[model samples]
Target: MYFVDTLETEGLGNRSYLAGGPGGAVAVDPPRDIDRVIAAAARRGVPIAYVAETHVHNDYVTGGLELARLTGAHYLVPADAAVSYRRVLVHDGDEFDVDPVNGLGLHAVATPGHTPHHTSYVLTERGRPLAAFTGGSLLIGTVGRPDLVEPRLTEELARAQHRSARRLVEQLPDETAVLPTHGFGSFCSVGRVGTDATTTIGAERHRNDALVKDVDRFVADLLAALSDIPAYYAHMGPVNSAGPRPLDLTPPEPADAEELARRLAAGEWVVDLRARTAFAAGHLAGSFNFEGKGRLATYLAWLIPWGKPVTLLAASPEQVAAAQRELARVGIDRPAAAATGRPEDWLRPGDHLRAFPRATFADLAAVWRTGARPVVLDVRRSAERAAGRIEGSLHVPVHQLHGRTAELPEGSEVWVHCATGMRAAIAASLLDAAGHRVVAVDDDFAVAAAAGLPVDTSDEAG
Candidate 1:
């Protein structure tokens, strides 16, 4: 029987797929690492016949070229992609037979909005629609933001995005699965869409806010809701356009304590990927903690200077491997060195291990009631803060905190927080490193609001 299996790239918050027929399969929107796709096809006892890319992705590097070369499959990309490679450049409405004996086929439908050349694929068996690989368009509850292309074309593409989303629902069967390549916590989505894993054309029509009949409002809200694009995104286009080399996943050389200290002294980034609370408890001085389980790639890529060599620091070899894989997704291949162990063990004379305090929302509320003055630094994004924030809390989105540190009152006591404690830990580290008395509010946002803390929405959250 033919079936479609999802391959999740969690750090990037996107998904790739392998659709297998009788003896062959097709991979769609694959990541730079092709091992999982290869393994899935091998388990299905099928050869990969084709690799399809929905667009020239700006989110992450594609493994299409490498996967095709490794598996001897045809690489399919949009005809208008201007890619510097040789393969099947498909146009709208083109169809390919994956394995005719099993009645499996792939059809390309031009759905430009996420980019000028975006395409969505509909999976068919015996000419009946089974699912649509709606890459960066017609997502589970939202469509891809249309501002990825040229600034001038943003509005034009937004209108097209609305039309394309409607076309998917109008043309496909109501029961056809809507497997989107984006929208699963990816920055590609215009706003926060529900993470419900199941999706269908009928469900989207009934529930997806972006799919409302009013195209004008959809366009307006989508364009307006586009927050800051990640700093690393600008480079993804050029790399994917020109083409990228096959992934090299070999472990980088391990750095000993002295070596790490030397690298740190030389100003190389050594990002610690332990949990936030663990990181705050005790960490190597000059290292940044971005919690490996969290959005390591997104935040690290955003903060790291472009083209800088990074040294990953983690607790276990397994964690270093995981952090390495996540880094490669954003094309941060080949760390200068990766070290795994306690920061205290890496200490030397004048090389310090630092720790910070963590507080609960209730503790903060008690201090506030006593009129104890600590700048409640709300480090969430502006959009999140605009929803609601602690009254009188200073706002500096975590991503902008590094550069905007000077804006924060010099040496002021700071209690930093985000929706959850992950970002709060990051903000706390930044504050502590800047010589401020820092405490992380290590609890949920709801806990803070319910603790009888003042909350407001009209405070010009900047």
Candidate 2:
């Protein structure tokens, strides 16, 4: 009997797989933190025989190289990917015995759409296909985005993605498990992805865009729906291709109150990783809040100036460590400093804690009843804004907010909101740190219309 265990990095919206029978296991698209993969193998009571990469990932650093080195496993990477390190260059239709005793093996199928070198791996037991690890090519409901590699090759890649998805459906059994690495919530996905935990080739055949639409339609729709990618993604592909450095999860140096203040004053990122509510209630002045419970890596790495020294202030050491791990996955390997305790603990002597109000759309409506005209800043993506948005609101996606803060109207209290409140809180913190009075709309965007706000449901939203 064989087993497949999933290792999900929810912050980055990707999944890695560990699958094997009695002989050994193979880890597919592992993250930078190899300890979890190691622990999973330990629990399975199997030495990992191989670490496979579907392609050079553009979302997070791959742990494949280190995981393979540590386990003495064959590191499988696409043959065409230009990498500095040594690896088993996997080619189309290449087969490797994962468990010769049980007749378990992996078959590489070149599925070049997510990247020119992207490949999908099929896990077979006794020459019968059991699962297909379709890295960025064949996802649950949508295919991986093709524009990540190079803008000039986007349309060509999109056409390639269609062919690749069809190839998987044609070559694999209908029941072959479609295990993908990018669609869970990763920006690597292009269209509306399914929320189901598991899906098979048969299920995806009826619904997946690549399978449902012809190549021309699929490519057109994919290019149309493509949204802004995380700024940090620009670094991930090169890091993976060149071979990611070993991950370091060591707690950063302790930052005294004065040092924290000095760093903040120097315009360094002093991130407060507390619950959004706690952060809104009180935080050290000039400290930005990226809730420890939220997508810290995705947002922080997307917004912060690349290579800026970061200092973390959290309510506890565990929170700091957790944030550090999340950041490390996206290549923010080392935090300059960290502090734990209440906001007051990180405040310098004679300095007071800063606060911003968190209100719902109802409160926003109530404020408008009194004729208050605060600048409502919609920080959702442009695609989301185009679907529906509060009329007259200024739009700036959260990732672009740091550099575009000047575009927001000055001398007005900015009321910031996103699909949910987490991003709004991040934006609120940014506005607060920039010396603007802000209110975080801690409510779902779904409630905005019912709250009597003027919502414009059209292609154009100001």
What are the models' TM-scores? Answer: 0.97, 0.99
Please identify model 2 stretches exceeding 4 Å from their true place. Answer: none
Candidate 2: residue 379 Cα off by (Å): 0.5
lDDT of 2 at 405: 85
Model 1 regions lying over 4 Å from their true place: 459-462
Sequence-dependent TM-score of model 1: 0.97
Question: lDDT: which candidate is best?
Answer: 2
lDDT score at residue 172, model 1, on the 0-100 scale = 95
What C-alpha lDDT does candidate 2 achieve relative to the native structure?
Answer: 0.92
Residues 1-462, candidate 2, lDDT per residue (tens digit)?
A: 889999999988899999997789999999999999999999989889999999998899889999999899999999999999999999999999888888899999999999999999999998899999999999989999999999999999999999999999999889999999988889999987988899999999999999999889899999999999899999988888788889889889999998997898898999999999999999998989998889999999999999999999998899899999999999999999999987788877798998989999999988887887779999999988888998788888999888888887778889999998999999999999888899999999999989989899976664
